[model samples]
Target: MPAISDAKILIIATDGFEQDELFGPRERLLAAGAQVVLASPGGDPIQGMVQDQKGDTITPDILLDAVDIEEYDALVIPGGVANPDTLRTIDAAIEIVRGFDDAGKPIAAICHGPWLLVEADIVEDRTVTSWPSVRTDLENAGAIVVDRSVVVDDNLITSRKPDDVPDFTDALIRLVEEAEVDA
Candidate 1:
């Protein structure tokens, strides 16, 4: 597992994020000693949906347009039907993902979260997994989409659904740790 101590991680999401997808991985990452910073379209707290129905909100640490990707070691995108749907339409959100990719930083996206990957135009020729609904989007974007608990291709890690959060978080930790070693 990665030594997350002092490692900074950026989580991108917005209103309508799946509660589990956002909180589950965030808590695990924090417990592992990483500094998790939440980013959204604006600085306001983003709402989360439980199983697509229940609602709650989480305050973001930074705004998408204001964030400096160079300050973080990794990025995570959480999925909710409304979350990624809204995010994909935001230019700033897409740019943040692209910035992380250009920086060669580790990234993890779970469930419907992979939608941003397609929007950022980073899925080409890459292997990934995501919630069933977005598999076609990934495929159409020229990615080799798979059905799995977790798939790690280079610095990017992805998982199929919320049920795969454990595997997703573990892979993210390993990737960050490995990046630290390589750096």
Candidate 2:
């Protein structure tokens, strides 16, 4: 299995994804020597939002439908109000998340990203954290929600917001390293 130095990380996102939530982790992980793959519902460029408005754009590495989950060692979901809301409605996106969870792979989500987890029905009885506005939804989905920078429940790593990106990505990197050691 690939370790932190070369672990394949899959980031599932779309237009309107929180800018920092996606790039923060991706950049940090890449600098740490991991292979990060950005996949979206579409293969075109996806626009990112900072908070409530446009921020930047990123070209997806591949389309969700074309990706083989087995190639990735972990999954990351970036949150923006519209990003997860739109993804939750996509069957492929939900399945990708569930596949990683079922395989006991590290799945990290921040802010509204946890919405996908809820939609995948994998949060039941699991403790997690997310942007304040998303706490209720996670609770409704049976997650024990907390107000923290980062929360790790088994292989699931979650965080509250953009400010928590550093901690969030760090936890994910650590998880990747641990998984590598275990493997």
Candidate 3:
């Protein structure tokens, strides 16, 4: 299996992403020696949220429509009330999520991030977990929803909230490593 140091990870987010949900996993992934790239709708800075309050802002490394799914080893989706909600509405964003799944790459989504997966229509029969409010939507989309800090089913990794960032990041890293072995 290829080491995480050799992996390239792509994170897609937009305005109102959960601050920790985006940064925590990203920090850990970079520390593990992965090349982490962030993509936004227009390659602009996006605002983050801490609960109901606005948090920090980050500039994306590329435009969502400019991403080529084949270049990355895995995908990460950080959740906030508006992050995934806004992302789901973008056709390019939804197609990116679907492309990752279709390519059999690892996908890690937390909190409301799974809404993109749901929007991509790729959640059916997959086991996943997300913020409480999003569980019903996952179930409605045919996912087997569960309550947990982190849940991993095949190449998909999910977590309940920001508190689960550590476990969520670990699961994503492991899945990426395993994908290397498969490749």
Candidate 4:
């Protein structure tokens, strides 16, 4: 693992986020000593979905409208069918993605999470991977989408699905650590 002490990681999600996709990586990042902040479309608690069913709910630390991309070192998008679908429609969420991209900061999206990247128009010509269902969307956005446990291209990292969380989290941690070093 990398030393992420004092690192600030921002996670963007909304209702319908995959339970594991959000919590698994959140826990790992916290354990690695990174400060994790959850941001959502609204300020209320966001419900999570497990295998497409209702699961636990978590209160967000901030609202998408309030996040300043420069305040955090990295961004994480946890996916579920409903999560990204809702996120893509939110201008604040899309702007956040754009801000991260323009700043050259690390942005990690898992499963259907890459939908936000497509919405922000940042995946064009980037190599990425996401849930099987969203492969076409990614490709249509001009991204070279692949099927893999995790794909790290430049400062963007992506994964196929929940089963790939371990590898995805590892890649994210390393990316953050490397960014910290570069800074």
Best by lDDT: 3
Per-model TM-score, in order, reads 0.96, 0.97, 0.98, 0.97
Q: Model 1, range 10-99, lDDT digits (tens) per residue? A: 999999999988899999989877899998888788889987587789999888888899899999999989999999999989988899
- Looking at model 2, the pairs that clash are none
lDDT by residue for model 2 (5-123), tens: 77999999998899999999999989978899999998789999989889999999999998798999999999999999999999999999999999999999999999999999999
Q: Model 4 clash pairs?
A: none
TM-score of candidate 4 to 2 decimals: 0.97
Relative to the true structure, candidate 4 has a C-alpha RMSD (angstroms) of 1.2
Q: Candidate 4, which segments miss by more than 4 Å at Cα? A: none
Flag regions of model 2 displaced more than 4 Å. 1-3
Ranking by lDDT: 3, 2, 4, 1
TM-score (C-alpha) between model 2 and the true structure: 0.97
Ten-residue stretch with the least lDDT total in model 4:
1-10
